[model samples]
Target: MASLLSDIRTKYNLLSKTQKTIADYILDNPDATILLSITELANYCSTSETTVMRFLKKLDYDSYQIFRVNLAKELIDSPSETINEEIAEGDSTSDIKRKVIKHTNTAVSDLEYSINQKDIDQCAEMILNARRVTFFGIGASSAVAIDALHKFGKIGLNVNGFQDSHLMNIHCSHMTSEDVLFVVSHTGESVEVLNAASLAKENGAKIISLTSFSNSSLAKKSDVFLSSSTNDKKYHSEAMASRIVQLVIVDILYLSVFMQNEAKFYKALNQSRIAVSLNKT
Candidate 1:
């Protein structure tokens, strides 16, 4: 079913001042609106109950109860209205393109605002100067860790990422003060990753956490914390946007490290090229 209050807002100019007030209240607090009786809604919006009844009828509902039931259904079915709201079908290609651009732009802007420059610099410096860098992640985050290892390794840094929990624990146990441990988790509360970070800490390794939330357990345990932001949808399906933010942070770290030690970075680059050329022959 269509959103009743959105319809009212779209036609707001046509609504009476009393109807408008009720409409605004319903839009702002949809869940609470569903729970209120017609009399309660009238009192809450400072209008007569007759106005509330008229408002529901104007929206094509047979009664206020039906209107509220439909609204509650909408809320229950879509917990995050920002992401779950349906887009109207477009009749032209340009209309579709415009919608796509708007969505992408919002995601990009969200990521940009969520990042902190100082955190990025600190993480890069720690990794660059460390004698060894141990990357830890599990499941989806493990893929990120492996990707980070590939980039950091190219810049002449010793880096390793482990997916297996047992292997991760074994590696963390060997980390020392001269080493750095980078933990990646979207939730920042993954049990295996947190345990690994704690073990690395016990061994005196400086820990850096890359997570979506700064207040997560992994972040609290780390020596430095870097976070990426994504607009969470109803199903928490912000993975695509979140991954983009994470990769951006990773790129920043990689470049910072490269710039901090330009000579070593370029030397490693040349060596990698030579090795690839030799293998191709």
Candidate 2:
């Protein structure tokens, strides 16, 4: 079953003004409003009871009561129950350090709640069976793609990460069902990444998307949608937190792939180490 939170995010763009306000409140305080009455929710959202009903209908819920039940269920099932707060302006160095570390750890811990083990195992199987794996990302995600390329290559996987827009298109254009395309984007709305993903899908390549939201375009197009937690303060992009989660996901995928063919992977790992060690001396 699709979680109400994910469904809300997917349909957020189509909501009315009053509906958006209610959505914003629910998203910000999911754990709190799960038990609120329709009257209370409407008052809290600064809208009428009718608006609440309309909003529920918009999301395809049978009734407001059903919506509340689903929302509560989603909150309970969510990966991380960590309540996010904005970083204060005045803080000691130690305070800042503690805050950043805690937030990063929360992001990683939340991944356990968001991703299913079966999905991870399935994706790993796809990677092992794929003739080639091509990674495509734009902006900060490009760095993640490159990192994944390096990690997987050490395990002797046929992989490459593409940063250049034209090159990404060119490479994806030639891919077929035998290939796997990994697209990484925090917002999942990168135009270049979407274009390449579309071309790859058209050419019959399976897409594995790593993003922060499951309702994003990239997620919609993916054969497997992987999401990470994202909570950034005002004026601060999710560049750091989201990137950390992306890297962790990459590491998990790499490890899963490594475990699948342990003997062969051990040989490849040793050979790569020797090749690099020779350069150091």
Candidate 3:
């Protein structure tokens, strides 16, 4: 059930020039490529069969047929889902608004399809039982971690979000088997996040990762992994859609925990609401 398309997209930049050319063609016309033989695909890409075979090897496929089989399966699994959303030049405000809404809706829909209930249950249980929970992210991801801290902390959980690498490392150093670390990284390759996760794991804390890409370093290190949709559109490329999807997952986690033990957390939730409402003019 490994998705060849996801693998290709996740590692596209790491491929060689010839391999990228083949990858581009395949991504553009995956349905067509699935029906084509290796020679046909090579000719279509204006590359030789040897080059195509090399590209397959780069993808870690033993044979082109297996690669094609997985590609076909990916197409079947995803159907018409596309991460690339188009915003045309000289479009009106309404046009941009509609496109943005559609893209965000698609991302949320994909999350509903991508997340597994078992993973959610396990993560919720970990959060419920952990002595302390730590959230770690950097840059834009730091905002996400901070938001998670607010949500989880409001539930009476001993939670903290660390933005500084040194602070996160220090926190991890004091962590024990009763702690849980939740990491948010779109690429799962952030040096600071990885360092914190490694140190936390060494200190016997459970790690939960929320990432867009599967088979990433953070994903491999996590006790629980949750995937989100990619926001790779050319026009809005600052991970806008990806961040929304991640926040939604955080909301889901928060709700799951609250629903499981509403009586225990209800007072804290109402207090948070009352505290925020006090600021109203």
Candidate 4:
């Protein structure tokens, strides 16, 4: 039995029209269902009280009150509970500072606990030996991909980062057995990114996946998987910590490549400097 209202929606087509109306209302106003009585819900959904009762029965609940109670309990235990309902007015500066510090510290600690040296080493080895490297990410992660390109280029490696889905597919189509494709996804479920990784795999390119979820689609498809901690406060803040972790991984690879081929790294650095000097007034 699915307890989530989302799951209930999946089975909604099986319900009667009146029951479906109540289900839609409950889904849209989950908090209201917990706080409002059956009469109130019936009036709000423009349905009769009997229709609400039948809706609960279809969901396998014995009564409307029981359904509301369970829904309230679920809401209380949900991840959104950690999110503030509204910003408090006239908040002290110190109070705001403390809350920020606490969440940041938690994010750092989570990242520390999640790191694995063995995985880092393996990722480094694959990257060092690959004939070509391609990076795929979207949104904020696209920024991370750009940073990776800069770092890898500095160390005398051929790296490309793509944000556009169509261009990414085009790049993946050119991948061969000697190429390595690194995919960065915080949620691990970005459809376009996963599809690119799939295409890269089909082309025989080695895949390295960086994501927060160990069981994510990209992770499941990769030849090597690296996970960063994003289990902090449940919002974009969690992704901030994830980017920090991804940057750390990029730095590790940069250092490892430099150490392995110091002369080549120095040559690349000098060439970059001279190129900049040529453009100077």
lDDT winner: 3
Residue 105 in model 3: lDDT: 77
Q: Please say which candidate is ahead in lDDT: 2 or 4.
A: 2
In the range 1-281, model 2's lDDT, one tens digit per residue, is 54566555445545777998887678668877877999999999999999988888877876888788877776777745434444578877787777777667765665665667887887899899999999888888989999998998988889987789999999999999999999999889999999999999999999999987677899999999877645543435656777987899889989998988899999999999999898895
Looking at model 4, residue 238 earns an lDDT score of 41
lDDT score at residue 128, model 4, on the 0-100 scale: 88
Instruction: Determine the C-alpha RMSD for candidate 2 after optimal superposition of all C-alphas.
Output: 4.4
Candidate 3, residues 71-162, lDDT tens digits: the string is 88777888664433468899899989988887777667656556788999999999999999999888988888999999998877899877
- Reference-based TM-score of each model: 0.64, 0.76, 0.75, 0.64
Candidate 3's TM-score: 0.75
Candidate 2 off by > 4 Å: 1-83
CA lDDT, candidate 3, residue 142: 87
Runs of candidate 1 exceeding 4 Å displacement: 1-105, 235-238, 277-281
Alpha-carbon deviation at 34 in model 4, angstroms: 32
Error of 4 at 154 (Å): 1.4
Instruction: Name model 3 segments beyond 4 Å from true.
Output: 1-84, 88-92
lDDT of 1 by residue, 1-281 (tens): 33554345333334667887887677657878888989899999998998988877767777887888878887787655423121354536675555444444544554444456787788877887799998878877877788899888876788888889999999999889999998889878889998899889999999988887666788899888776644333223446556666777788788888888798799998887787698784
Alpha-carbon lDDT, every model: 0.73, 0.81, 0.83, 0.73
